[model samples]
Target: MNRGRQIGISVSAAVLSGLLVYGVYLLQLRQIRLTETAEVVVPRQFVPAGTALEREMLTTLRLPSGAVTAEMITEMSEAAGLEASAPLGGGEPLLRWKLDKFRLLPRRGEATFQVPRDYVKSVSSGIRAGDRAIVYLSADGLASRRLFDEPVIVAAVKTAANQEIDNPKSSNLLSMAEGDKERMYASRRDANGSIDAVNLNLTEAQWLALDNACKDGAAKLVIAYDAASFGGEGETGS
Candidate 1:
């Protein structure tokens, strides 16, 4: 009788331990269910100028907690019906898509111009987000320095009407014909119309040259292609 009682007690303890282990496993399973994977929405198209995109137009997508990675963008673009390899516009397109992906946030800031409009004419107006520009500054009152020959990364043409040329829709200064250019020059020379204030992304040296030229009252601008020239040392022929 004593042996049987000891055996019964051992069996009861083992069963209780098994039950506790099973309960803990069930709790973990429930926790995982509570944190199920969810989908998010991303942009599919490059919204062009004059097109209105609403917050509701974005398509929702699903991504697991550990699934977001660098390559996931390509996958997301494919799933969102957008060409994963398509090139995006320089500033606005990149910004809009990045915002859609929740990768980058958007913020507004003023583009300030160091030169006044009476000096440069709104030549910066025609520039777009992706267009290239050659910033020129009068060099010693004889020629002009090509401060920058790179493409315009972000154009503030929209602001051309305002103090900073904020409006992107304004016509570019380089697009003017000879006649138009003459008229613009005449107006600026007369000082009766607005000054030629333009904004550009330039290096520190270029900025310094522009400022100096403006102060010296001999600054001018010209639009041209960017070129690189290499020269070798030469000697006088006999």
Candidate 2:
């Protein structure tokens, strides 16, 4: 009789262990499902570069969590009123880098000047707006030093070919068919032409100094981006 009791006790213990394991397995499955899906912000229509985002232009979707990147914006409020840095298509996830605030052209007691294309290319192609760059003055392109003691912020980077594409004047043009716009951008991006120029946001004194340098043809503009100072990463020079 004792042997039978012991056997019954073992059987009960095994069944309870099995039930606990199964419950844990079910919880694991639920956790996986929840983690695999997320709500992300997506464009409702073609969003062109430099166009400010509005609530109507965006919508949310339940996307696979694995498919979303860190750069993908999750909220419409985060994107609204910001400009698109690049073109995004319908149903595409809006990325953080594809938007900008335009910031401002010039502040009080400040001015802006356009740096020649050759000068902008000297530093590298990654030059972006809001970057602080040191302008080098040299009669020829070689052997130069800083033009000013203070650094200057880049207001804009304009490629001759991409100007019209980025700054579309008409609202309809902004919403143009994706294919047509893609073709247009492809042609512009591929064309052999003058590519990049930097618009320097400067103080009146700084502008005068740069202007004099350019007019005399005694110095050429050579830009060196202060990578550490770009986009609130470090101190911005006035």
Candidate 3:
């Protein structure tokens, strides 16, 4: 080959070698990140013991996998509003065992209200704790009156026998296979009972309105405004 042609071939070979090395570097970097590192939720600031963690106070951090075990908190939702069992340093990964698990009951200054079984005449079956819904009172099953001026947060959902689902008192059966989970849930629901009671946190005025409405209303229906992932809340595609 001519000198110019040989130089052109050498240039092409050099470019190919450079691309191969760069690709190998990228692959190694990815492998290192995937195997050696873990994403976990950590406190953005030094949090004292018994301090409630909020979304603003927590952040996602990538730390070594050995530093974050399977029992470590990795989601913001898991640590949000939970009290720390021990003091945590800034940027330290939160251990799941070091957080207190509290029931989703009413906070201070809020009263509790249980949804009567008769109130769930045409209600959504998938309502759980932390869901906000508008409770309506219907006289003839046609016209309905608003029970409260706003949606109320559900504190707990109980079966007819009063078994709590969200705040499990060590129901290990729920952690099994997906089929077992369905069966366990279905067993809670399969008595043909829609919902025995749904505990709600309400103010005095809101409680009075609901109490008075229940006395006069012939039927009731709860329509959930917020969406839970498992339910068919999408009547409209909006």
TM-score of each: 0.35, 0.39, 0.44
* Model 3: lDDT of residue 211: 66
Q: In candidate 2, what are the lDDT values of residues 1-238, reduced to their tens digit?
A: 9999999999999999999999999999888976897888988988766455789878998887777789988988888877676778988888877776553345435667776554332653444455557777767665766789977766766666555223233221222223254443343334343436568778878877777777656566667656454333332222
**Compared to the true structure, candidate 1 yields what TM-score?**
0.35
lDDT of 2: 0.64
Per-residue lDDT tens digits for candidate 1, residues 131-223, read 335556554447555656553223333343454332224222332222254433332233222324434544465556556666655665553
Residue 4, candidate 1: alpha-carbon lDDT:
100
Q: Is candidate 1 or candidate 2 better by lDDT?
A: 2
Residue-level lDDT of model 3, residues 1-238, one tens digit each, is: 6999999999999999999999999999888876787789999989876566789999999887766788889889978978676778998889977775432445445667776666555555655554566666666746767767776767676676777654243232232223254543444344333456778887787777666666555555554544432243322111
Give the C-alpha lDDT of model 3: 0.65
Top model by lDDT, which number? 3
Question: Model 2, 8: alpha-carbon shift in Å?
Answer: 64
Cα displacement (Å) at residue 160, model 1 = 6.5
lDDT of 1 at 219: 60
Off by over 4 Å in 1: 1-72, 75-114, 121-125, 139-141, 149-154, 159-197, 223-238
